[model samples]
Target: MATTPAPATKPLHLVYTVTNIQHKVRMLDGTKVSYSSWVKLFQLHAKGYKVMSHTDGTQSPAKTDTEYEAWAEIDAIVLQWIYGTLSDDLLVRVLVTESTAYEAWSRIKAIFLNNKGSRVAALEHEFNNLTLKSMSSLEAYCQKLKELGSQLNDVDCPVNDQQLVLQLVRGLPAEYDIITSYINQILPTWETACSMLELEHHR
Candidate 1:
């Protein structure tokens, strides 16, 4: 007698659906946001959907392997996600008929992350945008800003302690306006600024 087949409700292997990835990620306009941020969100999306290997270069199967065709199908879906999320100008530059998801991903990443200059620019942009939100503790905000400044310092673009202090002041919540004004008048060191912010945070 013939055996019964697997349940029809189960999705078959090799079946993939469009993620409409752009809605989950912004279109990379090469200026609106840093590429690292864009790519991080995209990678997180891929990881959640269990398709990260397609874009990360660690899971290519041999053509003769039984899983190869299914892998290719998923890879094609990943490639589509990459293409769909890119701006038209970026799409034209990195899009190639024969590219795998990994190839396209790397090309786009390199466009913004290739040089020391680019890295510094990106880090500074992120630092400049940092803010103390209600959801984050005051300590964390100060620490993150310091870390970004340190990263800039490490790249030979040293953020003087005064500049770091000013940046931290800029990100302060309005409740700290009085102390921030005092801090600015003093033009204290970053360490001094953090201490002031922390004391204000507790009040």
Candidate 2:
């Protein structure tokens, strides 16, 4: 089988016409616990457009390579995509005059990785302290707990299904005391726990 080589100029490709990417994906808020999801969304976007290599260094061509200039151009575009999606604080920290897409990407990643310990502690504390009284409603309590649990998992400090179920049962208002005690007797998944609580609320 014969294969046609790619164009020598990067921007000539139709996929290089990316703009307003910041509007497409949520910007990177430096203090957010949802950093992993944001990273996932950006990677998915980059992969769909055939530009993952510009950020991951998987297909990097050296300065002396024939495709080097084109690669650099594509990389710069990818860098701009990242810059556009970053919060002002984050952009200021990672931006460099001559940085490659991979350099900026890795530096930002390092920043999150280095703070994982503190993030884990803070999220865990908040999750543990969360209760139905603190939220607007039963649904809100569940939603916030789930968000915190997911965020903790993203930071590599996961709370297991059992723990989530337990925590959900633990935070109910006084009216839920009887149902909460009943729920505590069983080993339900988090979804089941939420459903049981809802059933109790309606009854």
Q: Tell me, by lDDT, which candidate is best.
A: 2
Model 2 stretches with alpha carbons more than 4 Å out: 1-14, 30-33, 182-203
User: What TM-score would each prediction reach against the true structure?
Assistant: 0.59, 0.75
Candidate 1: lDDT over CA atoms?
Answer: 0.79
- Candidate 1 regions with alpha-carbon error over 4 angstroms: 1-15, 118-180, 183-203
lDDT of 1 by residue, 1-203 (tens): 99999777746533255446777878876555346557778888888788888777796989999989878888888888889888898899998879899999889867655687978888899989899883268777877786677666645577888888888888877888999899989998777888888888788
lDDT of 2 by residue, 26-49 (tens): 887744436677788898988888
Error of 1 at 89 (Å): 1.9
Candidate 2: deviation at residue 48, Å?
1.6
Pairs of residues clashing in candidate 1: none
Candidate 2 minimal-lDDT segment of 10 residues: 10-19
lDDT of each: 0.79, 0.82
